[model samples]
Target: MRLVLLSLLLVLAGCQAPASNQASQPKVPTFYNHWELFAIDAVKVPRLKPAQRLDVDRNYMVSGMAGCNRVFGQGKFEAGVLTFENLSTTMKICPAELDRYEQSITEVLSNDPKVTMYRGDLVLRANHRVLQYRLVKETSSQ
Candidate 1:
């Protein structure tokens, strides 16, 4: 009886071992895709009527909306760091609040920002500002 009980316990222990080992590997976050800015500097930004979004492809080309203007540029992401260059926006007037918001976003994008992932959201920190974006899912027109 004792031998059987010991063998049973060992088998159960072996089964649980793999479960713990599988969870030991942590998930690494990747940002080579599209995301939407949901908050700036910790303040929630309401979704725009026509939708504002940011796209960063595998080639690191940056294109998106900044307030009421269209923004396009080149970006680099390596070693967990991100930076944008030559960012240009369309010459369009916007509401005072949106213009201010655009300034804050462009300011960060123009400089190098520390990037991290929190609760599945991509976060960028720079110039005493924090930009939090949520991943945008791709939809097919079909």
Candidate 2:
């Protein structure tokens, strides 16, 4: 009887054991949300009157305002890298500085960027450029 109890206890313990494949488990993408560009290459992004944000959905679709133009595209995220395909942007003429910023942003997005989450910030690295974005929390006003 004692041996049976010991065997039963061992079975229960085995059942409760944490999964051994935890490390190999697929990483859940936490970058799916509204994000605002905070910095580029360690420098603060130029202030823009309009909304400067990027929205990434679970389907990997991306859309946002990059400084002066509105950008939309289908994105593919895999193995910690994000790449956009056929990215299209509005051709609205913008101020020289904002236009420059927009160009830089598009360039970064065009290149497959390595993505990492650091201290709650989404960091993208591509072509020696680091683009940092902060999550924009949505608030419900009743």
Candidate 3:
């Protein structure tokens, strides 16, 4: 009886899946979710851009002014927590127009792997960096 019960408990635990596993199965990004200078390239460099209207329902994404070179791979978040596999940025000589994105995304990704989004602002923290993001005024969730 004891052996049977132990086996059943193990089976039950194995059947249970964590939230992260469940969240990644679909892996679709919502509006203003995980907005980075990296993602759909919403930031127009020197000037920030809105993400509520940004569409990232594709394989590859390109945003920013023109030659931003700042981008990232597909990422998924479960219940508002970010998970990154690997992010690749350009090694090219970025002009002054695209410098903001390089700095911004680098600062963002270097900090923390976790973020919190409220209203139009996003708070991202990793190691020593804390980032505050303001979404487009019109798309405020508040």
Q: RMSD for each model, in Å, please?
A: 5.6, 3.2, 9.6
Model 2: what TM-score? 0.82
TM-score of 3: 0.43
Each prediction's TM-score versus the true structure: 0.72, 0.82, 0.43
Query: Candidate 2 lDDT, tens digit per residue, 1-142?
Result: 9999999999988876656567668875578788888898999975577757888877779899987799999989889999886888998999987877787788888898888888888888889988888889632320
In model 3, the runs with Cα more than 4 Å from the true position are: 1-67, 95-101, 110-112, 137-142
Ranking by lDDT: 2, 1, 3
Best by lDDT: 2
Q: Which ten contiguous residues of candidate 1 have the minimum total lDDT?
A: 133-142
All candidates in order of TM-score, best leading: 2, 1, 3
The model with the greater lDDT, 1 or 3, is: 1
Predict model 3's lDDT versus the native: 0.47
> Candidate 2: minimum summed lDDT over ten consecutive residues — where?
133-142
- The alpha-carbon root-mean-square deviation between model 2 and the true structure, to one decimal in Å, is 3.2
Global lDDT scores for all candidate models:
0.80, 0.82, 0.47
Q: How many steric overlaps are in each model, in order?
A: 0, 0, 3
Better of 1 and 3 by TM-score: 1
lDDT of 1 by residue, 84-108 (tens): 6577899999888778778877888
CA shift of 28, model 1, Å:
6.3
Better of 2 and 3 by TM-score: 2
